[model samples]
Target chain A: MNEWLLIFFMAAVTYLPRYLPFALAGKIRLPQTLERALDYVPIAVLTAIIAQASMIRQGELDFSLTNYHALAALAAFLVAIIWRNLLLTIVVGLVCFTALRLLV
Target chain B: MRSPLFMMGRCFPETYLMNYRTRQFWLGALETLPLILAAFPFGIVFGALANSNGLTFAITAGMSSMVFAGASQFIAITLLANGTALPVIVLTVFIINLRQMLYSANLMHHVAHWPRFVRAVLAFWLTDETFATVSDRINRHPEEPGLRWFYLGSALFMYSFWLFSTILGYTLGSQIPGLSDWGLDVAMIVALVGIVTPALKLRADWACAAVAFISSLLTFDWPQQSGLLFSSILAICVGMLLSRSGKTNE
Candidate 1:
């Protein structure tokens, strides 16, 4: 029951942001400033996520080559730049990470 | 009481195969396939991690079904394992999911013709994968009709994949210790970067990415990942300010 309760809360909070904009936005125009901020969401949020996911290990900042996450992310970042293919980037990123983890 | 193919035919009797909606739906699903495949590993990670972290099977499955957000679900499992308070966990999840508001707001104009209640239904299903997959198509063809079906196809496809993987992970991950630590989460990061990098064509966008990367790194140790929230907001504001400046209008 407690777990279910938590799920309920999680669902509600998660849904509220997702639902409110759809419910509210169509009828009116938002400020230009807000829309500009919205445009930044993709780069801003995902980059932030990548930062921690790749660079932080065991609750510490990891910049060393042994941090395969950061190294593979760098490789993935380069692939994304040159080829600009998501599937290719992911394939290269995973292969690079796996190779580093095993070889290093 | 019939197979879905029959149901699909029943729903579109006249143009079962010739339907544009059906075409768009499948196309949307096809576009999302690669990302879905990448995320498959983490689905099991979540379930296996949840199981090891002492969550019951029902709770694990329930969170998948109800919350349906990926990163938040993982964080919730971690916080639950640490015996964090319910309110705090919920608050953190809410903060993390604030990004969804950006997604919905960005897509609002495309679906302006949709009824409010139906839009709410899409809101329920809107996720990073669905948003990322469908937004590209929507931006490319703003005037295209039947995109709602396309969006629905992507959402339903990703959602089912996620739930199934969670169950599989829970069932199989127990036999394979240290699965979560294997860094399968990198799949998500790589996939996300692939999406974001191509979108970073504008100068302000690059600025946003740089600020997000640096600030997030500096604040990574902050409690409950508050630094993520701070970094994202700060980066967005900076990007917006730069964009608003007349010189960087391009």
Candidate 2:
């Protein structure tokens, strides 16, 4: 597939769900159950993405010691809890991950 | 459908018709400045990664402009680099971004009365950062009429920062050398941690996250990253079941 076409397709698929709900926002009131379910999406999705990025590599699981991403993500998660600041957590994670990379 | 205008909404009533759109805009932008800064390193890293992955500067930056999603864009570039098929790549990104539907739904009640064009623009601008920032603002000042402008302010600021930084990183990545190898992608994860930690106030929220994490680990080997889709679905189902059983707050 042409790269441009792929990107366009990506943009379209990405845009539809985002726009559909808002476009129909006033037209339909969501059921109570569905609304509650929607509330959990952010946490679920964020955790899933983070896990995939940290724990997966090349379509396989890599939870061994050499998996620097999982280690760094653990460090970053700790920093996020302690400092509760986004910038500090990123800075600490970058430094910790890079340092760990050098050691491993 | 009854006009929501007549409903005694849970959101605070518009008490004062104060014309403070500009103030609210600046406030929203200022409040989200930290997140924008947090997202900066990720933007740089994404550009560098995309370039190193064989994406042209045009397509690399175009993805930023059109898709406007960091994680999904990163996933798409990685899949493309691995010679993943276009259909698979598109489907993967779409699934990755499905969470945005929640953001859209969350804000629907607040912005339902908005015009179609305005809602369209705002919907396009919705992202994790903007959703967090704007949702915080609306929760605090539910009665504020300037909420829409405030949302625009934050979203546009983050959007512009992402675009400019991606370009900056892309242009410098070649000349600077080793930029992609610097492990800056970790910054995105850290920033996400920062954003998601506060939302773990409810037991169901924590349960949802835990299920997703464990499920992602177990399903990591699924082809074309479909494991991500499965994990998300599983997590949502866990969350919904918990909520349904009345074991956790709704």
Candidate 3:
């Protein structure tokens, strides 16, 4: 449970994925299918993260109006579709969630 | 990618290359300005959460300095909060960063011939923002030389700003008794939504995201966040499968 040890493990794993391909570049190529699948990794991982963060409340699925996180996320998604801006989406999402928490 | 600049610099190669590198370095840093603006608040929020999640101030900021991966850092802190096992956190962070390999492989095709030191350093600094910036430059001017300098410029600038923002967050988190508990972590989710929503260009990408979201929610209570790992793999497979078929999942 050493924080330093955990950080070290995290740092090492984070670096390997990035450095391995550089070490093998030109010498070895990954399978074409894997190369294709890698394109979806970001999308899949980020979506999963977003889902769990906004939809779950205290170990249960909270799809009701009390789930301010989900509502704010919906607002952010709408802004993203229209503006396609990172800062704007985050600002709007945070503002919406904070406002909901205050008013409701 | 050799661009016309390389050919035109042939007359006085040394001076031309020097200026090209200097110019590209500045240009790379300049272009990354907007992205850092978007990502800056996330770093601050990360520091605050890490601090409140029983991490020491030093370790909270240290995590940002050493790991330097925002999404993974956020996940690690959340797992840390839940008292998830270290090995599981390591695996999740590794899987999240697996996308960096694609960035590496795609970029290495061009920088493979560069010096090992340069490539290694660039690998260390690789992030979603720098990767996007480098790709934009290459797509616009494939033959432009001095890409290494440009990459370094973008990476170094982002690193400085990211670290600074983390320090600020640590300070604020310390001053505010309940800031981290205020649902500030949602900022990371929305930041990613900003990134993911724009990039959902293909039918396969949409399929990947749709499956990931639904499955993750279904498996949210699974032990040690195994649900996250499972959902990501399942979604990636679905995406690749749909991409291969008649756009079946589209």
Candidate 4:
């Protein structure tokens, strides 16, 4: 489990999943149910990442205003929905978070 | 199997055609620029975080280049530096990146005819950002082809920017501090928001988002970040149930 070996091992494992589907894509026909399942993957994955990043704090859950990341993320989501622009959504969210942190 | 050059040609058939479609290439490039620009700060922050977390500059750069995955690499180095078990770190990274399997499957429709060597190279560069750009372009102009150049331009640009920014972050470290504290991670989040908001056009999509948001809130306390995974599963189950029930009703 040396560092280089670990890196290569992880890289191989990671790349195979990304590569195999494309390599064998046409040769195999995906079931309709599986295709439908694939559609849900993005939102599911994003939700998990967003949750892990915003909700969890220091191995615990923080729901109050003290958990500024979650609040900021919510604000960012709202702004993103309203504006539908990536740059503006991020700018507004970060600015609000910074301002809130400084004032409160 | 076709040779690398032949596969590359197939990937970019429009470029070889007498009437090449320059518009798709330009459009693809333009579409990807915004994401790349947003990802710049994230890469810098990741590099800086790695440095602060005791990773050497070489390791940080290597992670960025070798892995070429923004979110997973960030999580991996952060967790590893935090002394998380190597297996846990690897598993988490693997799960976080599982969505790429879908991207690979979807893109396979386009690249299945490619040679093994060509597929190997492109797979290394196939990222969410790349997929978003390429897929949107291909869908819009299914016949107007030149996909290879489009993929090449978008992937190469993102790859270069990520590498440069990571190096910059590693070199600057604490010297150029406060960027992450300033909510620079929001930029990455915003990039995701941009991608997700546009696709939330259906009622099912809206419901899925709602379920996802609520589930995350309700299960935020779970240990080892399992709450997030649970929330995602909950959201998917809700979405599938709704879709199936709706179909049955019709």
Best by DockQ: 1
Give one digit per residue, the lDDT tens place, for model 2 in B129-169.
89878876665577878788888889889999999999988
RMSD of each: 5.2, 7.2, 6.4, 6.7
Global lDDT scores for all candidate models? 0.86, 0.79, 0.80, 0.72
Candidate 3 CA-lDDT value = 0.80
Q: How much is B8 displaced in model 4, in angstroms?
A: 26
Write the residue-wise lDDT of candidate 3 on B141-188 in tens digits: 899788998898899999999999888888888787766566656666
lDDT of 3 at B64: 85
Model 4 Cα lDDT, one tens digit per residue, B1-250? 3433355457777655534434445445556877788788888888888888887777777777888888788778767777777777777777756668767866766776677777778888888778877765665577656787678778888899999998888877879766566566655665666666655766777788778877876776664456666776677777777788777563
**Clashing residue pairs for model 1:** none
Ranking of predictions according to lDDT: 1, 3, 2, 4
DockQ of 3: 0.53
Q: Quote the RMSD, in angstroms, for model 1.
A: 5.2
Model-by-model DockQ, in order: 0.76, 0.55, 0.53, 0.42
Preferred candidate (DockQ higher): 3 or 4: 3
| Candidate 1 CAPRI grade | medium
The interface root-mean-square deviations, each candidate in sequence, come to 1.3, 2.2, 3.0, 2.6
User: Chain A alone, TM-score for each of the models?
Assistant: 0.95, 0.87, 0.81, 0.92
The residue ranges of model 3 lying beyond 4 angstroms of the native Cα positions read A1-7, B1-42, B49-57, B71-111, B128-150, B247-250
